[model samples]
Target: MTAPGTDAPSTSAQDDVLFTGVVVYSTQDPEASAVLVSGGMVAWIGPTETAEGLHPGARRIDATGCLLTPGFVDCLPTADGAAVDDAWRASAASRGITGAVPGSAGIREGMRVLSPVAEPLPLKDLSAQGVPLAFGSLGAEDALDPWSWVRAAAHGGDPAQRISDRAAFLASTRAGLRLLDVPHPGALNLGVEATLVVWEPWDFTVHSSDIRTNAWSVDPRSRTPMLPDLTEGAPRALRTLVRGEIVHDVPGALG
Candidate 1:
């Protein structure tokens, strides 16, 4: 039997990705430390020696004095871009966080995410249309297929997955934004019925720009224009500037 909040009951005992060892983060702790991940979620975290001593046959990763932090979480006011909520949950689960909510008004993206598994049913609109469906709306516009995006964003990625392709969605959103002006920092997605909130975290020292706003920046509303808001760029930018490493692989929202 699985323990509470530990691992779900597995009918087949399969070898899963196990991250056992120290973890460094920009939040909760600044110094180097240890962490543990199982089934893509952070099951335990502690000092290096403690985390290391937990399990055997696990992937022993040396933080090598790298900075670790909870994934950057930007609420409504900041751009809660894609590839984060999915990617973080997978890898960061091993570090310490399992799930994070994304804040935005891009419901269409959610639909796209579920399109492949099923015939993209609009759960919400379905109720209105008097249609019954099982499953909730999935947002995948800014979000990419996890494994696909990872490969695309990783070294020698396929150019087809570039952010430029997302410009089409931006174009459509821009047209919508014209009818609905962008919201203020505190109030985003004002006209929209349901907006998703995105939470983004950083792996290294984050800067003011990481969550701060700029002229083109708006808050609380789903990010429009297919491009990441000014604040969204900061996390990936700072991560690289700080450690010369790529945590989320900087899924470029815009060129």
Candidate 2:
């Protein structure tokens, strides 16, 4: 994130000429322009500005600039269990936002700590260092897996294989949250790993590639693949995918 601009603080954008320049703003529609922002919030909008008595303090900024709308501020959790905060709160705040929320399994207080950090980490040090954590069911090491694997371990457990998926963890977490569940997501320390992969391991061997690839699974912010509209009818991908028939056969169809 670009550091917040350093300049004179403004009580308001109008009346004082802090900076003045052509600015463009947009809406959900790609071809739509809604309101124009001045200092940080939306200022004058619609039909393009031709206002009188422009503020001298206003710095001239180009309106030809493409609008970079902020991401959707998720006010709720994706799953039924806890409240989830965005994964990039720190970076977002560096850009200006003050409020943040996160929700994920085992992100609650007093969970176990496990990780591949070279530095030895105990429970106390992990929490202090803002380490990624999981529920009591999983140690820090288990949380670091493919998204499906993490969710499976976090939500469920498999004693036969000694493997627990995120779904199992999620169930445990929900049960843990019988009272006031402080919903928050865990940390994702991947940016540095990406750097290492780029600069250090250009010639990664098959074994090394396997190790790096096993570093972590794709961390999709969303928990599940959004199915298409049910109203849009069934998808064609389920060829020979027997969905048990309710009636023996449709009125006009052959079995």
Give the Cα lDDT of each candidate: 0.28, 0.24
**Predicted model with the maximum TM-score:** 1
RMSD of each: 16.7, 22.1
What TM-score, computed on C-alpha atoms, does each candidate reach?
0.26, 0.24
Candidate 1 local lDDT, residue 18:
27
In the range 15-48, model 1's lDDT, one tens digit per residue, is 2222223233212332325444443334444566
RMSD (Cα, Å) of candidate 2? 22.1
Query: How many Å off is the CA of 239 in candidate 2?
Result: 49
Compare the candidates by lDDT and give the number of the best one. Answer: 1
Give the lowest summed-lDDT range of ten residues in model 2: 192-201
Candidate 2 residue runs with Cα over 4 Å from true position: 1-25, 28-35, 38-41, 47-59, 71-90, 94-98, 105-255
